[model samples]
Target: MNQVEHVANLARLQLSREELERLSTQLSRILAYMEELNAVDTAGIPGTTSVVAGDANVLREDEVQPSLSQDQALRNAPDAVDGLFQVPQIISDR
Candidate 1:
C-alpha cells in the first residue's frame, strides 16, 4: 500500500491511502492473471487476421455508361462558372 502510494505521488496522482490499498490488491491480481496467460503453449496454430470468415473482392467490371451533362453536374454547386463547378479561393494573389 505504501509503495503504491509513493509511486502514485511520483506520477502526480492524488491517491488516498485507502484508494492505494484497494488498487494495490487489484493490480496484484491483474499481474498474476497475466502471468497465468503467459504459461500457455501456442505451438502449431495457424495465425489468423479476422475472427470471422471474410471473402470480399474489389475487382469491378470494366464497363462504361452514359454520364450526366455539364449543366446537370453543376446544378448542386453553391457557385459555378462557364460550364464548370467553381471552388472558393484559398489565398490572396499577393
Candidate 2:
C-alpha cells in the first residue's frame, strides 16, 4: 500500500481513486512547503509562544456581595423540591 492508502486506513477513511490521487498531491505540496520553511534562517529571532505576548490572567479582589438565595436560584428551574434542584433519573437497572 502507498502512503496515501496507509494514511487513509489510519484515519478510518474510505477514499476513491481520484480523491486519493488528489489528496496525495496536496499532501506532497504541503510537505514540500514545510521543508522550504525549515530552510529559512531564524537565527537571533526570539521564539513567540503567543501572538498577544503578555500575561493574560488579571483577577479582581474577592469580596462578600449580596446575591440570590436558593429560593431565588431555583425559581426558574423546571423541577425543584425544598431548596434543591431536581433532574430526571437517567440510570436504569439491567
Q: What's the CA error at residue 82 for candidate 2, in Å?
A: 33
Candidate 2 residue pairs in clash (backbone atoms < 3 Å): none
TM for every model, in the order presented, reads: 0.36, 0.40
Q: How many angstroms is residue 15 displaced in model 2 relative to the true structure, after the best TM-score fit?
A: 0.7
Best by TM-score: 2
Predicted candidate 2 versus true structure: per-residue lDDT over 30-60, tens digit per residue:
9888898777899998987777858487678
Model 1, span 8-41: residue lDDT tens: 9899999877888899999889988899866788
Cα lDDT of all candidates, in order?
0.84, 0.88
TM-score of 1: 0.36
**Candidate whose lDDT is highest:** 2
RMSD score of candidate 1 (Å): 13.0
